[model samples]
Target: MSDYSSAFTHCETGNLYSLKSLIDHVDAQRLGEIKDKHRASLLHYAARHGQTDILQYLIEHKKMDANLKSENGATAAHDASVCDRLEALEYLFHQTELKSNVRDERGDSPLHLAAWYGSYPSLKFMLEDQRADAHIRSYDGSFPLHYASSHGHSECVKLLLKVAPDTVNGQTIAGLTPLYLACHMNHLEVIKILISRGANIRLKDEDGLNCLHAACRNATTEVVGWLLEKQNANVNDCDYSNYTPLHYAASSQHESLITYLLNRGARIQAASNGNTPLHVAAEYGRNGSCALLIEAGCSPLDQNVQHLKPSDLAQQNGFTDLSNELKLRERSLIHKALPGSNITSVTSVNDSVTQHPKTSVVRLVVRKKNVKRADVSLQVSENEIVNEIRQQSSTPSVENDTNRRRTRPFAQELQAKVLEHEANSRREPNNSDINQNFNSSHDSSQLLHSLNSINQRNQAGKTRAKLPHDVYGPWMKNLDPDTFKEQLNTVHAGLRKVRRNSLVQQEKYNSDDVHVSSAENEYTLVDTSNSENNDNTPVIEESIRGKEFLNNQNKLTSKTESFQSKSGQNTINSGPKHNQFTGDKTNITMPQWQKELIERKKGIKA
Candidate 1:
C-alpha cells in the first residue's frame, strides 16, 4: 500500500475520496501502522498541507505528530503558519506534543513567517495561542515588531508591541530600533506610537548614527523636523567621523534640511577634521550648499588639514565663485595669511641614544615650549593616547635605519619649516615633499585611524618597543614577507597599545597634545630615533599581537575594531549575532520562505 503520509497528502487537496476507497479495502489497523522512514504518520501530511478541513479530519482520526518538521526544519505547524490559515494554525498550536520553539534552520518560528507575510489575523491568533514567541528574532535578527515596522503594518506593530513592548524598543542586529526603522520608512503614525510608548530617539545604530541621521538619509523632511524638534535631538550630533547633520545635509544637498537646521541654530561653521561646511561643500562641488553656508556665516577661509582655506579646495575643484571670493579674501589679508612655510630647518640635536642603541624606534617626546616633562605614562587618558598616536604617526621608524641616514636632516628641516609656519601664522607647503620616499607613511583613512589610536596609547605605560618602520627600504635590503607582515601587524598593535595606555591617564591632561591634527588629512610616513627603554601594557599589546598572529595563520581570530574618530564605529561585531538585539543589520538568521518552500516541494518529489 502507498505510505500513510502519502495517502494523507492525497486527502488534503480534495483527494480524500480516492484515498478512502483504498483505505476501506485495507485494514484500519494496517493504515494506522503505516509511517514514513522517520515515522511521520499519515495525519502529519494532512496538517502540513494547511487545508483546514483535511487537517481537522487528520487530527480527529489519525492523531499524527503535529510538529513533525523534517531533518531540515519544517513541521505541520510551519506550513499552517506560513500558509496563513489561522484556524488550522490554532489547531496545531493547541496540540499537546507540539513545541512552541521549534526553529527552522534559520531560527525563525511561526510568528516570523506570519508577521513577514502581513498575515495579521493569523499572527494575532498565534500570539493569543501562547504558542507564538513574539520576541523570537528571525535569522535576520528581526523581531515581529521590526518586521511589522519595516513593512508599514501599523496594526501588526501595535499588537506585537502590546505582546512584547520590549521588542519595539529593542534594536536589531543592525543597531536600529523599531522606532528608527519606522521613522526611516516615514511611518509617521507608527513612529508616533513608538515614541509615545517611550522608544529611544537618541539610539545610535550599528553605524553610530541616530534616528535623525536615518531620517536624513531617507530625506524625510517632516520626520527630520519631528525628531529634531520633538526629541530635542542634537542636530549637530557628530557621526563616526565627527560629522554633524549639517555636514551630511551639505553633502546630500538637502536644501530644506539645511535650511531647517540653520534656523534651529545648527552650526554652519562646525568642522570635522577642522573642515568648515564651506570646505566640505567645496569638496563635493556643492554650490548651493556653499551659498547657504556662506549666507549662514560659514568662514570663507576656514583652514583645512592642509592649512589651506576653503578656497583652496574650491579652486582645486574649479569652483569659480568660491575660489574668487577666497582669492578676494586672500588679497585682503595677504599680509596675515600668506603661504611661506617653504623654509626648512634641520635641528642638530646631540642627545645620547641610550634607549635603543641599535634600533631607531619613534619615542614620544612631550615638551611644551619650556615646561619640564611630567611623569605621566601610559596610564594616561584616552584623549592623550589618541593624540599621541597622531603625533607619533608622523615620526618615522622602521627596520630600514639607513633610509633615515639618507633622508634624516631633510625630514627634520621640513618639520622645522612646519613649526616655523605655525609660529609665524604662515601656511606651510600643502603638498608632500616630492623628493622624499616617505617610508612608513600613513596615507589612507584606515591607516590614519590606526595611527590616531597609537598616539593616544603613547601616554599609556610604554608597550614593548614595536618594530617601527622608520626605515623600511634601505635597512632590510630584502625584507622577509613574513616579518614584513609581522611589522605591519606590530605597527597596528603598537598603535592600539599606545591608545590603551593613554586611555588610562589623567583625563585632565587628555587634550594636552590631542593631535586631532592631520595634513590635508594625509599622514606622511615619518622617521624617529630610538631613545627610551619601552614600557609594556600586556593586555593592550597582546590583543594586537594575538590578532595579527591569527591573521597570519589565515584565520580571523577577531575583527579589528575601527572606531572612527568622534564616533565609535569600530567594525566590532556590534552585529546582531553578538548580543541578539543590539548590534547592526537584521542579521537574517534563517532561510527565506521561498527557499524553504522549494525544499518542501523537492522533498515530495524525492
Candidate 2:
C-alpha cells in the first residue's frame, strides 16, 4: 500500500522524487484509494502548491483525477485559485481539462476566491487568459466585485468592475452594493475605485443602514469625512429605527468620529423613541461620547418616550458615576439659563464648592442698577443649594429685599415655580379661582382676601354636626330606671372585658420581650380608635355614662321636692351641706363621658 500521508506531504512541499517513488510502488486501484482527511487526492495538493512536475507525475504516471473534490467540494483548480498559485492554476487549466469556473461547496468560483483573497496575479490571469466569468454570483448572491470591494483589493475590484461594469451598482441578496461593502469595511482605495466606476453610494441594506451608517460602525473617521464631504452623504439620514450615523458613532464610543460627524452638521437633537444621541451614549455607558455630546450642546435633559432623562437612563443602566456627572452638567446648564441672576461665569461653581470640616461661605456679589451693592455670603456644600437665606441689612430697603430673595438658588426654586406656573396656565377656564386668577394682574392683598374667603367657605361647609344630641335627648328623657340600669351594667361589663384584654396583651408583650414597631403600635391605636366601628364601643360607653348622669339628675329633683315638704328649720340647718353638694355638682354640669369623648376627638384630629 502507498503511504498516502507521506505522498500528500511530498506533493505539497514539491518533493517530486518521494511522491513518485510512493506512487510507482502502488497500482492504479490503490492510487485511486489514496486520499487525505478532507478526501483531497494527490493532484489537489500538487496543483495547490504550484508543484508542476509533481502535477505531471500524478496525472500522467499515476493517472490521478484532476477534478477530484475535497469535503468542501474544492477541486484542484479551486485550491490553486485560493492560494494565488498562477502556475498551478495554469497547469491545471492547460495541461488538464480542469475548467476555470468550477464552484466550491459554497458556490464560490475560482475567480470569486481569487478576487476575495486579493490574488491580483491569479485574478488577472483568470480574467484575461483563462476567460473565467467575472460576473458569477455566489450562493449569497455576491459577485466577484462584491468580494473584491469588501476585502479591500483595489486592483481586483477595478478589474472586476471593468469586466462587469454593470455589476458596480449590482446588489447582493441583502441589498449590499460593492460601494456599501467597501465603506463598511473601511476600504478607502476600493471605495475610490468603486465610486470612480459609478458605484451607487446611497444604496441601503436590508436593515435600512446606508453607507454612512455602516462606516460609523467601525468608525473610520477619514472614510466618514470623505463620505460626507466628497460624496455628500446625508449625515442626518436615519435608518429604519431612525438611528443616524451620530447615533452609531456614539454607540461605538468613537469620539473622533462623533466630533467629525457633529462638525459636518449632524443634528445633535435627532431623536429615536424621543432619545437623542446623548441618551444613546449614556445607555451604552460611553462616558467619553456622552461628555462630547453634552459639550457639543446636546441637552442631557432631553427625555425619551418613557420620560427618562439621559441621567435617569444612565442610572437605570447602572452607570452611577456617569449619571451623577450628567446631573451636575444639567445643574450647570440650568444655572447658566436662569434669567437676571447676573451669573457671568459659573464654570467654576462645581469646582469651587468642596467639602470642608467647617462650612465654607461662598461670597456672591450682586450688581444691579440703582440697587444697593450687598455682598451675600452663602454656606453651600458640593451639589447642595441653599433654598433661602435671610439677608439682614443695616438699612433695609424694598429693593434690597427683592435682590436678597433673588440671590438664593434660582435653579431649583425658579424651575419649580416656572413648572407650576405653566401647569396653572394650562388649567381649564372653569377651574378654581387660584387657577383663574394665576395670570391676572390682581394685587397681593386681593389674592390673599380671595384665598381667605375660599378657606372660610370650605370651613363652613365642613362643619361637624352637633352629635345628634336632640334625637338622643327625647329618647333618654323617656327611658325608665330599670332599662337605664341594665344599659349601664352592660357598658361596665364591656369596659371590664376591654381592660382585661389590654392587660393580658401588655403582660404577653412584657413576658415575651416582643418589641412592637412604631408602625404596628400606630396601627393598633388606629384600630381601637376607629370611628366607624359597627359595635359602637366608644359611642355606647359614652351614651351609657350620659344616661346614668340623667338618672342622677332625676333623683336630685325628687330629693329637692322632699326637702320642700320638710320643715324650714331642718332645711336651714342642712343649707351648708346642700351648698357644698351643689357647688361640686356645678363642676360636673357637662356629662363626664361627653367631655372625655370631645377631648379624645380633638386628640385624634391633632
Candidate 3:
C-alpha cells in the first residue's frame, strides 16, 4: 500500500521526480521508473500544469499510460479540458481517440468542466477537435451552454451557440433558460450573443421574471437597456416582486439609469410595494436620486400605498430645507414693514490694534491727538478692514516713543488701568503709567483697551488673548463659582422665574427637612424639659415632712409594680406546680408516687 500523504507531498513538492529517480537508479527497474500523480496519471499532471515541453517529452520519449484513470476516476483529457492549458490540452485531445462523451465526478464531461471554469481556449480546442459534447448534461442537468451562460462568458457563449445552437434556450435545474441567468447576472454581451442565437427574452423562471425585468430589478441598467432597446424586449413587464424596471432604478439609487429607462419607455409613475419613484427617494433619503426624480417632473405630492405623500416622507426623513422649499413654492407674503429699537452712536477715539488668526477683533485705545500718551497701550495685528480705518485716520504714534512725545499723567493712569485688566485676564499687564491729561482727546481709551490693541503692535511678539481662555491672572476657584452664580443671576428674567420655581421646589424639600428636624428638636426639648423638671423640681418637695413621705411612697410603688408584673407573668407561664422546681436537682426530687409508678412500669416492660 502506498502512503497517499507522502505521495501527494512528493507530487506537490516535485520531490517525486528526484525520489523516483533515486529508486530507479538502484536498478529498481521499470517499476521505479514509471510514475504517476497520487490520484492521477502523468498526462493528467501534464495537462493541469500546462508544461508543454515536459508533456511532449513524456509522450515522445517515455511511453506511459495515456488513458490511465487514477483513483479520482478522472482521465488525462478531463484534467486537460477543465484547466485552460491550450498546448497540453491540444496534445492530450490529439493523443486520445475522438470521444463525444466522457463523464467526471460531477458526471460532467471534459466539455462541461471547461465551460464551468470559463476555459474559452480549451473549449474552443475541444470543439475544433470534434471532441466537445453539446447535448450531454451534467448531474444537475446543466449542459456546457448552461455553465457558459450562467457565468457570463461571452466568447464561450458565442462558440457554444455556434456549435450547438439547439441548446441556446435549454432550461437548467431551476427551470431557468441560459438567457435568464445571463441577463440577471448583468452579462450584456452574453445576452446579446444569446439573443442573436434566437434565445427568448420573454422567458421567465419560477420568479415570473423575464430577462428584462430581472435586469432592471437587479439594477443591471446596461443589461436592461440592452434587452429592451437592442433586443426590443418588453418594457412594461413586471415580476413576482411586483416591481417594474423604473421602481428598481429609483430604489437602487441609480439616478442616471432611472432617467434613461424612463426616457426609453419605462414608466415614471410605476409603483411597487405602494411607493412611486419619488416616494421611494424621499423615504430612503436618496437625495441625489430624489432631486433627479423631482427634476424629471415627478410630483412630490404623490402618495404611497400607505397614502403618505413624498413631501410628508421628506419631512419624516428630516429633509427640513427640501420640505420647506417645496412648501415655499406655494407661499404668499403677509407683511413687509420692519421695526427697530435703541441704537447707540459710538465714535472711537484712538488708533487701536487688534489681531486674530480666524477673525478680526476691535480693541479700544485712547490717546491725545497731539502728544504721545503713556496711557496703557497694547499691540495687535492689523486686518484689512482695520487697516483701512487706520489709513483714513491720523498718523499713529509708536508705544515705545519716550522723549519726542510728551507723556500725560492721564495716559499713565490709562496704561495702569489697562494693565490691571489684562493682568486679571491672566495676561501680563504693564505697570507703566500713562500721561495725565483729562483735556486731551483720549477719553475713550478705557473701553477699547482690548479693541484698540487690535491692529497696531509696537512689539510684534504679543497675541490677542480672547474670551475665557485669556491668561492674564491667576484663577481663583472661589471667585469662579461666585462669578458663575452671578452669571445665572444675570440670565433672562423669564428663565429667572423657572430658576425661582426650581429653587422653590428645592426650598420645599428643605422646609420638609426643617420640619422633621424641628419636630425632633421639639420632642427632644420637651423630654429635656421634663427631665430637668424631674431633676430640679425634685421627686420630693422642699417641705420637710412632705419630702420624707413622698420619697418612701415612690420607692414603695416602684418596687410593688415591678414585683406584681413579674409574679403575674411567672404565674401565667406556670401550671399547677407553681412552687415546684422542675429541674433543680439540689432543691427538689421527683414525687414518691410518680417514681414508684415509673419503676413498676419499667420492671413490667423489661
Candidate 4:
C-alpha cells in the first residue's frame, strides 16, 4: 500500500520508470484500490500535472479507469481542466471514454473548474473543441461565468460569455449575478466586460442588496465610484432592512470610501431601523467613520428607533473617549443653536465677589458699559439681588432662615440707594436750597460728583444692551398676549418632557433586570449594573467585561436548572445567552447567504 502511494507521487513528477517499478511490486488489482487523502488516483494526479505519457500508460497499459471519481466526484478530466493541462485533457477525452461535462460532488463540471481556476487555454479548448455545456450550474446554482467573473479571470469570463451570453446575468442560489460578483471582487476590467455585454447594474440579491451595496460592503472604492458616476447606480438604494450603501460603508470602517460615498450624494441620514450611518459607526466602535460622519454634519443626538443615540451606542461598546467626544459635540451644537447676542465676555457672577480678610464684608461688583441707558455699577451681593427678584415675583423660597436673615441687610442697603436716587431726581433743578444741601457736606460733594458723571454718560449716545433679549426679555411689552402665552407654554412643555425622560432613565438604571425592547434587543450590548455610589445611576460595563459577566451568569443558571430538572421538576431558564447581549448586529446578525457571499468575494472557500 505504501509502494502504491509512491506511485501516485511518481505520476505527479512524470517519473514513469519509478511508477512502473512500484506498480510491479503491487498486484494490478491493488492499483484500483489505492487513493490519496482526497481519494485522487494515479490517473487523476497524472492528468492534473499534465503528464500525458504517464496518463496514457496508466490508461492503455494499466487499464486505469479514466472516468473513475475521487471522493469529491472529480474525474481525471476535471483535474486536467482545472490545472490547464490541455495535452493530458486532450488525450483523456480523445483516446479514452471520459466525458467533458461530468460533474463533481459540488455539481461543478470540468468547464466550471476550468473557469474558476482561470485556465484560459483549457477553458477555450473545452468550449471551442469539446462543446462543453457552459450553462450547467454547480451545486450553488452558479454557472461557469459566475466563477470566472468572481475570480477576476477576464479572458475566461469573456470566453464563457461569448458561448452562453444569457448566463452573464444568471444568478446563483443567493441571487448574485456575474456583474455583482465582479464588483464585489473589484475586478474593474471584468466589470466593464460584463456591463458592455448587457449586464444589469440595478439587479439586487435576495436581500435586496444591489451591486453598489456589495461594492461598498467590501470597501471597493473604485467600483463604488464607477457604479455611482459611470453607471448612475443609486447611492441611496435601500436593502431589505432599509440599509443604504452609506450604511454598508460605515460598517466596513473605511473612512475614504465613506467620504467618497458622501461626496457622490450618499445620504448620511439614511436610516435602517431609524439608525443613521453615524449610529452604525458608533455601534461598531469605528472611530474614523464616526469622525467622518460627524464632520459631514451628522448629529450625535440623532436617535434610532430604540431611542438610542450615537453616544449611547459608543458608550455601550466601551469606546469611552469616543462617547465623551460625541457628547461634547452635542453640547456645542446645542449651545450654538441658542438665540444669544455675541458676548464680549462670559464671567460667572459668583466669581466677581471678594471677601475681606480682616472684616466680615463681601464686595460684589457688576459693571455694564454698553447699555442703552447710563453705564451702571452695582456693589451688592448676587444672592441679595436674586432674593430681591424672588421677593418681587412672589416666588416660593427654598433657602434656610439663617441665609435669609444674612441677605436682609444687603437687600435693604440696595433699596435705600435706589430710593435716594429717585428722591433726588424729583427735586426742582433750579431751587437754591437743593443746591446748598448738595454742596454743604462731604457726602453732598460725593453725591454731586456722581451726578456729574451720570450727566456726562447721558450726553453720549445710548447703545443697546449686549445681553440676548429673546431669552431674558420684557415679554409683556415686546410680544402680543397670545404670543406670550404660547412661548410660556412651549417652555413648560419642554421642561416636562425633559423630566419624563430623566425619570425613565432613572427607572432603567435602578431595576435589577434590564430587558431590552425588541427593536433594541438586536443592537444593545451594554451590561448595566447598579452603582454603589449615592447617585443611583447605572455604571455601564465594557462590552468585553459584560460578555464575561453574562458567561458566568449563564453557567451558574444552567447548573441550577440541571439540578432542578434532575429532581423531577421542570426549570425555567432566567438568563439570556451570551450572544443575545453581545456581537455587532451588522456582522453577527447578517443572513447566512450574505455571509457566504462576502466570503466568496474575499476569495475564501465557503
- Give the distance in Å from residue 156's predicted Cα in candidate 2 to where it truly belongs: 1.6
What shift in Å separates residue 306 of candidate 3 from its native position after superposition?
9.5
TM-score for each of the candidates: 0.40, 0.52, 0.40, 0.53
Candidate 3 global lDDT: 0.56
The reply for model 2, stretches above 4 Å from the true place, is 1-3, 27-41, 269-275, 282-285, 299-606
User: 70, model 4: CA deviation in Å?
Assistant: 3.0
Write one digit per residue (lDDT tens) for candidate 1, span 1-606: 354445755756757666666564655456556667655555555655656666655555544445555544766676666667666677776754665567777787777767766778888887885657788876768787887877778888888888898776788777878888877777888888888888888888776788777776665578889888777889878777566777767766677778888898787544446677777777777777777887786756455444556656765666656556554543444322323323223111122321222323233443443454442222233235445555555554674466547445654555555454345322221123211212222233334444444444544634435555656356545678998788778877776554433222212221221111123323221111111322321111112243343253222112433433324432333221222212232121221222345446547766
Residue 501 displacement in candidate 2 (angstroms)? 74
Return the top candidate by TM-score: 4
**lDDT per residue as tens, model 4, 414-526:** 55665676577455333334433333333544555555444454456343234566666666567878998998889766755544443333233223333321243222332
Of the two candidates 1 and 2, the one with more favorable TM-score, higher being better, is 2
Query: In each prediction, how many residue pairs overlap at the backbone (N, C-alpha, C within less than 3 A)?
Result: 58, 0, 38, 0
Worst 10 residues of 2 by lDDT: 509-518
Candidate 3 C-alpha lDDT tens digits along 116-191: 7899888887787765668898877788998888787888888888888899888766668898878767777787
Query: What CA root-mean-square deviation does each model show from the true structure?
Result: 37.5, 21.9, 30.3, 34.5
Rank list by TM-score: 4, 2, 1, 3
RMSD of 1: 37.5
